[model samples]
Target: MSDTTQAPAATGSTPASGRPAPRFPLPALIVMACTTFIGIVTETMPAGLLPQIAGGLRVSDGSAGQLVSAYAVGAVLGAIPAVMLTRGARRKPLLCLGLLGFLLANTATALAPDLPVALAVRFVAGAFSGLLWGMLAGYAIRITAPERAGRALAIAMTGIPLALAAGTPLGTWLGTTVGWRWAFAGTALFTAAILAGALIVVPDAPGQHAHTRIPLRKVLRIPGLATILAVVFGWLLAHNLLYTYIAPYLRQEHLDLTPDVALVIFGVAAIGGVWITGTLVDRMLRRLTLASLGLFIVAGVILLAAHGSTPLAILAIILWGLAFGGSATQLQTAAGAATGEHADAAISMVTTAFNLAIFAAGAVGAIIVDGVGAKSLPAVMTILAAVALIGVGFGRRAAFRTGR
Candidate 1:
């Protein structure tokens, strides 16, 4: 928890505050991102092996689904407390310890005897994940050149899309090739390697103003933060509503691109989106945001209008990845931009909203899909994307007016 490493001075750059930031080591940044990648891959690994797990443990499909949801639940409920409780801890050591716990959790899941035991193991793993995500942005920024914070953050955040893109297919192959338990065991091994990397490469990062507690009131009082939260919440809700049911929707539409293939296309597009936005965001925050949301709107409309068309469906999937792909970069960058020095709490709040939005959208999307129709989900997404666009406008204006 102590500052085990000294902050290194920024090279060739001074921030708007006229202070030099520590120049983060690249390996450290990479290890940080890898930790997240492993955590999420482990968290979502069960989805690819659900039937096997259910059959192996003698549980129903619905109960198996709880294993996946448990992690999201833990993430949503744990973000704030995790961030706050570890507020003063050294970033590297804390992240290392968290990843270690992650290793244990996955090991536990791999060896769990019953559905109830696996669910509990996953929830604990999810809490560790929540802590890692909530702090990652601030940690990235704190150790990077002040002017290049956005890039540093972008690099660190690449884990989310990467895990989403790779986790299922890889886990499926592993689980299918061997057994369901092997997937968790394999992830535990991967996590252990990343943990070693973290210990060796990552420098300790203590908060700049470690003595001052970032009060929730102060974060809430920040101009346009509410709007940022709104955009993140609404945008995620809109995206997940349809995303959770994408395969069924595709079946209903009779698209040729199988769900798995479509996911690959989406994941690749998202990676492209992240790198592109990371480069442009610091320079054109508001414009790029509008553009990002616009892509989602276009994607939704495409799916709604061209449900049965293969080409358009392909386009829709690509667009979905592009817009939603760079989301972490945009949202976390917005948090850093809005909160300035007090970004940890801001990041935590945004992260909590982000986590909760996943479940909310899933539940709501299920209702919409189950009742009206599958295609209706896209219609709802388009509406939500529009709301998010409006929120971006108001949010930027408010932040400017208040000089945030």
Candidate 2:
């Protein structure tokens, strides 16, 4: 975390000793992107298949929701250890191992005959997902030039929102048409593809610092890192509170919409948001963060007002998706910039905070739904969105003072 320990500068076409540090090749970037895509698909596919899974397992819909919550819990717990244990390991092998774990876990889930087994398998899948995402962010940064780091990170991260846009709808369709098991099986296949791609594409560039000597305390003490973590946690909590309930809420309101339709809309809007924001991120990350937060506030308000009207509700959701997608890249970029040399730790902390928010939001949303019904969701989201705006304001002020 010390400026003195900054990564060795890239000399003219080579390191100082004349050996070339590996360049960020397109194939390697593709491999890392696939890894992120697989992890996200595995984590989010269950959201679209929850009803089918619940029916198959002989449980209420709310009970099946626990499967999603359980996965998040696993992610929150797994992130830090995954980074610490694998620190300085080669990127290709780490990615391969992570995808292999995901493949096995999803395969187990696909074959499991009972809800308990399915939940446990999902937990395992989430652990690997957390590891993959945390490592991928740092790996992507190392492969790209400093000026283009934000863009590179966004490209790698496009997997997650893309999964939501395409993978979720595909999983939902497969589940409804064939069976939920097929959805899991398909995820396993995607995992396999990601593993194969990673093994072929990513180069092994070990950090110059002694792998065993990461200064944890120094990393934690970095300026603005802790504040960014707090903002990310709040932002995620607000988003997931509504996200976890979106499909169910629509169904309960008798909107005459299928899970596939909902997912398709959500995914499309999310993908569009991610694509547009990725282009703008390098030029205006801070401004985009503020704008995205403002959009989130508007989306939450619209969600509150349009809950009963099907067309209006759907429109609101698309706006929500756009806001959510844009916010993700901004948060990750902000966290990475704050951590500098310890980007891996920064990413891990953000992943951990993000998942913890998911679990908390899901649990809290369920309680709200059960107690006060869907009508309360908007009020909850509004409060969280307001807090996130406040956090962003504070962040901007702090950055201005520090000339960051």
Candidate 3:
């Protein structure tokens, strides 16, 4: 990509290299964060409002749940091509385009009269989300100085956990208290505000020089890229296995915790995780990755042994949140660093893997809930965490290399 560094005199931040750094770009970063927040809230708020949505759409709750799946499907389908085709577009304008699409889709979703229309608009919303996520990290990197890339990315990705911690819950409350349609309308309003911010506040960054863009096949061959994606897949699969069915998991005969209470605890802990990760990720990328994976294993084991102990279950949820909260920053940072100039392509793959895991978790968790039961989730999550941990451990030379 052609260099598009913001003015170094704005923020006056400095790197360890003793050079003047570009502006910190806090407004732009926050806009990006809010963009992610809207995307996630749009994608996930349906889960919490299924009963209302089903009633309004005149479908069974199971059918309403397919709205979420439709979004995931759109994301998995759109991420790669959307990114690849737009590799040469100016970053800020492309982002505005995505935000506009999201605004329209959410607005349509809020007014749809039937399940089919709602699902189609939801799919469109997801496609725009995939486009934004695929582009966000690379844009953050382009606008920041090289030495401060990790911190910049950490800031850009803060929206992910924040979406889980605050946005989705608020949307759910708004949906239930007012109407489910209002939740989506609120998202559309937020997107409009963000779109305006992108046009006015975010600096334009040039896309990759046409000659520099990598073909999909060659991008796939980037060393360590596959390994990092493997971790993304397995770790998220494990997380969603429990997260997607947390209500049922909490409702298990032995557990005393309510889903609301458990999620509150998890969300708070996840915010802490993001804080810790933002503080340390630039210096200890590999260590942080290892520690997060290890914590996931510990959380799963604790859940397995919790029996009827409410405290134990709470502890497990806290650990799980801490482990998962900063995952996008950690993995996306690694993927961007690993792919060098081709980070957009790799991050698109990360987006694809992320949505695929979300889709798979719903299906897999459903089967587990029906056959072996919700209690089996912790054990399944533990096995997957172990596998990801091992992948990170062995992938050090390429995927999770030290000396960040």
In the order shown, the candidates' Cα RMSDs to the true structure are 4.5, 4.4, 3.5
TM-score of 2: 0.85
Q: Spell out the clash pairs found in candidate 1.
A: none
List runs of model 3 lying over 4 Å from the truth.
1-19
Among these predicted structures, which one has the highest TM-score? 3
**Candidate 3 lDDT for residue 238:** 97
* Candidates sorted on lDDT, descending: 3, 1, 2
Deviation in angstroms for 192 in model 3? 1.1
The per-model lDDT (C-alpha) reads: 0.81, 0.75, 0.88
lDDT by residue for model 2 (264-317), tens: 687778777877776766666666777787888887787677756878778877
Return the clash pairs for model 2, or none.
165-267
Q: In candidate 2, residue 33 scores what lDDT?
A: 67
Best by lDDT: 3
Tell me the TM-score of model 3.
0.94
lDDT of 1 by residue, 15-80 (tens): 567765455567888887787678668877787788899988899988998998999888888888
The predicted structure with the larger lDDT, 1 or 2, is 1
Candidate 1 lDDT at 35 equals 73
Candidate 1 lDDT trough over 10 residues, lowest sum:
1-10
